[model samples]
Target chain A: MAIEVNGKMIEIDEEGFLVDREDWSEDVSEAIAGRDGIELKDEHIGLIDYFRDYYEEHQVHPTMRVLVLRLGGKIGKKFHDHKEYEKFLYMLFPSDPISELCKLAGLPKPLPSEHDG
Target chain B: MAKKNDEKGTTNPELNIPLLNELEEGQWPSFVSDLKQWSKTKPQVAQLLNQLEESYENRWNYWTGTVLNVSGYGGGVIARLSEKADKYPDLAEFHTIRVIPPPGFVYSTERLRNLADICEKHGAGILQLHGLTGDALALGFDNEGTFAAAEELMANGWDLGGSGPALRSLQCCVGQARCEMACFDTMKTTRFLTNHYISFLHRPELMYKFKIKVSGCANDCANAMIGSDMPIIGTWRGPMQIDQEKVAEYIEEKGVEHVIDNVITRCPTNCLSLKGKQMVVDNENCVRCMHCINVMHKALKPGKDRGVTICLGAKRTLKIGDTMSSVIVPFMKLETEEDFQNLTDLIDRMWEFWNDNGMDHERIGEFIARVGLATFLEGCGIDPDPRMVQSTRTSPYIKFEELAPGLFEGEQTQQPKVWNREPDTREPSD
Candidate 1:
């Protein structure tokens, strides 16, 4: 999938997941981070590697609950705070223009489709 | 996924709806409004919404009628009807339709046609094929042919209803019957349970919504506990195979490395123990989660004494409060249908108590939890089992002999920043 983010078209990698940093335009990173349900921080840039490692091993993104559990276990911290997690995830993928960001990152198409109708 | 956005512009008379925010969710879900928004960006989704909305359309009569309870799945249809209003004059006002489908079976296409034909002529063609599920829906059907459609479906060996409070078709995710994880034959037990309880299903006395989910070796793909009022979980009761025995060699063949570290260790019980080229499960510590078995499928096998744990006092949802689902039948061998029938008899007694004094449509969990557990047992003339009762829930925590600092030094992490502000208050302890 390709999208014109910030006036430049970037192609999503073959993994059906975007990997290139240059491709991660401000909006794209925000959206991916949002989809991952993580807060975007400079520290989170390395998150791509972590996600890659997780995907390499599991062959899939950790679903929201699984991600939280892994995070809690890895860091020995409780992910009991729901509001912070939700906000952090959104902070990475601000929904101001969700569609544009989702497209640039090559996320799966939204649930309902033309075929469904 | 629940969020519906606006479509860009192609406004059609049918799908044009008002825009609704999260605030209006409790007030009214204006699906039409949200679809209007989605159509602006994703026109196709709006089209699908229209397709689904048509179920509410065209020449319907509303008859407020109730009938004797036939099956527990019957209540879902009632709940569905309770959701609708008299506003949709285009749809037939079918107050009720008897839910009779094969117990623990799904309907095929041809049978669907016959049921549709029958319901179309006699009752309303609105066949809501709502079997037993947590999120069962009320789908629109043609009233004219629904009865024939139901019949047609039955003729082709399709089931419409079976799983409810009455008896459910024991379900598993292609367990040992096929999957590498199952310790024994799950399909055998499933068929046995269904074969034994043909009469209990239609009986009204034991009619309570219940579901029994069995995920052969844990990896709870079926989510048995969350979805069912009475959850029957599979477990083994012997030594775990941790040595490089016949199955341990297949651990790598089955790709059991990465999952072992994550899934096995996550077992709330410390039942999973690992050795060189071997993975073992602790019979006494195991809580039927099957995580260890799932993670190390090749190295692990359930013991010969394989059975199910029947947890009672449970419900599908706890949106209101902490509903009690207790371990009633702690263990039962699946060798015969008699075990399944014993479970059914217990369920019938539970239903009789709830229906007799439940006051208002109080669910089984609510009714049992409202009155003391003792009262429920006394009413049903069931002998109390101290081992399986509610008070025995205890965590198996192993405390290592080490300094707490050594154990906890790497535990510190940045705390989450909370945004919801609150008025200042001080605690006496603080």
Candidate 2:
């Protein structure tokens, strides 16, 4: 199948994802995050990159737990608190975001959209 | 559909005569034993006989699936499935359809013809009507047969929802749809949830049981009192949606006494004040029984807060027990799918934790109490909630305003009178 990253699409195999973040523009990342009711920010780069890497390797995006566990202690202890954690969550995944994030990410439209915002 | 129950005879020697499986038989021999004797009586069909016998012993009345719908609450497909269950001799588990009757519609011209036709063609004619959820039940059909009827009904564009773990259909008040107390868009919400959670209806693995109820106004005519796990009682927080001209028209059309009797006196909260054509509701005292708004549809509109109050733990066995509805989410705004999803996710997490950890047949609320809400939340890996249980747990540092909104201020919530309340303790009506 062809990997559609940004506007410039490339052919890719089913076994591996179309990684190489260089292929994903800031617009693409922001768009994908926005769909999950999340926004992308300069500060969210690390978490987003982490999510991207985990997805590329494991073949599935990090769920809330993995997101928390991977970034919790790193982001400081306050991240564990529901209110604060939710704030951080809302920060990385804006209330809503860009567009065509799923197509940019080469995924299907079967699950609940993340961009509830 | 026409498979004969050839082993219907009391004695099929190929099957074993029933033998007692346990030594300490009570007033009734072990169901296994009774079945074994049945097997002997029908030795040729011993295997088939034993399956039925074991099913009868293992879990009857413990839990049974009832397909619910707004119409045929008293009579419909449920009655049909029940009528034919005896014919499918091979199946072990039997299913019954519980019909949800359309509110305020005790009688309708349609006579639930679609379901009746399906029943007449596919199931036994035995109908059980007006179940707890106002659903009608069709006894005598096994699980597969019932499912077939469901599929069969789907072909005719008639759906039977509220069977399993998925979102049950949203029930509406006899609202402006029928009654006068309705304000918010109930039929729309009901349609929304029903269409939204179509995937959940057949997937039974989600939890022990999940129920949803909607009432146009707080009159809770649908028995949000103790009917559903998440009770969405319509409430108006902002300005009333009352259209004065419409109110006059409604009164002129619906009559004054009907409105007064059904809307005013019926209000649990004495907030409605009526003087001929003009009526006022003390917003402060209006407990949202929805009567005034429903009856005075032309005059009284639902307040801006026309959303529903989502209180958890309204199970017939657990939350409904001991008296009183323990309101969880005091109020919720279901204006969007995201809101519904958030609410459903919370329900999903609760079920994942409780169903896995709880003893069989425990309601989610009861399980939370048993496992400790804190531990259960921890197990579910949800955001921390310091105060969820009602068992007198309180924080020393917190004041009413500072407290977690989910927490109760002490165990001082008002208790509702159970349906089975003692007549001696009951007060006489004025």
Candidate 3:
């Protein structure tokens, strides 16, 4: 399957992940998030960027706990505690922050075992 | 979708189940006899027996598939399908619904009857009073039948137990309800924790299965120490209560030789001794192993100040091997709501650390093994306690520089040298 971004057709997998990582761009992310009825905000994009960076460095997606911990060191001075930061992340992507961020970031879907309840 | 079995018929009398007949010949009560008795009224049982016989003959289990979950849930229903369904069509889709029983497993006759009726109507007429994990097993159902039975069970105040990666049903001993040695109310604590984490029980999203078992005292009737991820065991601080009169009476009845052989010698801490006719306990040295109290319940009792000891990271053999739980919190007063909330917060912290660091299919215990226990404790922000360690380090290679920085500085003008040298920074050789 495929989705159209900026009038150019881009291939995607059945779960809507990008068929090619190189095909991913800002416009493609917006198109993917738009399909899920989520308007891409700056915070969402920030997490998406972190997800891409972490994956590039570690060859794995950052778990919710790792994301919260690393993000706290990076841009979480506003939040008093890690729990509050986690709550903020959840508020940004309520269903599953890690998987949702990965999708918008154009990364492969995480293992089902890593998904939270 | 499969059709329901014809409930009007009985077992075929001409059918020869030679393998199953052998099971009924034993002196001990046999499950074969029970199944045969139920087969008289429920044809599903007879078909299941036939399937079992076929499995025994072929040296292979016919059961497979796990797509028997109820709506909006991913667990609690285990599929038991027969691969030989073409031959035993009636036994094609056998399943078991795991219903979470109440804390303490107290049940009224009416509730039991209702459960039996539901099983008979929507499932095969068989009820395993309790499964290994303490959930009531309602056996033998198809896909649609499972939904029907689950809906009726929920409406009648019964909920399904957990399976897969979810938090399993909380198992608690009948504490304070019937047991005299109980240090706290096991039922209340179990019920509260269960209700609080009901979502975790119903959902299947964790890395692997987690279990919590509560025991009322150090006797650990619930097998909390080795069988669960989180073990809440009742414990006491300070001296245990000892009635001298009752002690004398016990000595009179059981004899001094019996007391010396059974209670005194068996004390793990070697704190118990006899002073004339009265028994003496070295309270300061007592580890509260519950051996003396169990043997002489009439004379000895738990201390007045009682609470629970919470431990973490226990599981059966899997990755690293069987590991017993380690004490995290030596004592926690589980009386007030705030206390329970604090316990919940601790669990949340531990779970967060585990979920982030744990690999797929890795239990919390294995996670601790991968990352050192000190790292796990520090990551969860748990205060390091002396009781958490089984014993002080026996090796002389202690990190004294990190532990005690300036112990010998002022006293001897000699500094403690750090034993661990810096890593070799030289380039690799060809």
| Candidate topping DockQ | 3
* Global lDDT scores for all candidate models: 0.46, 0.49, 0.78
Candidate 1 interface RMSD, angstroms, 1 decimal: 19.5
Predictions' DockQ, in order: 0.01, 0.02, 0.08
Report RMSD (Å) for each prediction in the order shown: 25.7, 17.8, 7.7
Residues A18-49 of candidate 3: C-alpha lDDT, one tens digit per residue: 88998989999999888877898888888788
Q: Write candidate 1's Cα lDDT for B1-430 as tens digits.
A: 0111122123333553223233246766664565456455443344334434443343342323322122222222221221132233222223333344432234466766765565444432334444334222223332323344444544655444442234444555456645665654556655555555443333211224445565555455555655556666666666654436744566555556654667566877777656655655566766666555555555555566776676765564433465545666666765565766576566556655665576433456777767765577668776445455554455211112211224355763433222112324454432
Where does candidate 1 stray beyond 4 Å?
A1-117, B1-14, B17-89, B92-138, B154-176, B183-217, B242-260, B263-267, B271-282, B316-324, B353-358, B378-383, B389-430
lDDT of model 2, residue B427 = 57
* Model 2 stretches with alpha carbons more than 4 Å out: A1-117, B1-4, B7-111, B134-136, B142-151, B158-170, B239-282, B290-301, B318-324, B336-359, B371-430
lDDT of 3 at B315: 83
The DockQ of predicted model 1 stands at 0.01
Tens digits of per-residue lDDT for model 3 on B169-221?
88999999999999999999999988887766764545688889999998999
Q: Model 2, DockQ value?
A: 0.02
Q: How many clashes show up per model? A: 59, 70, 0
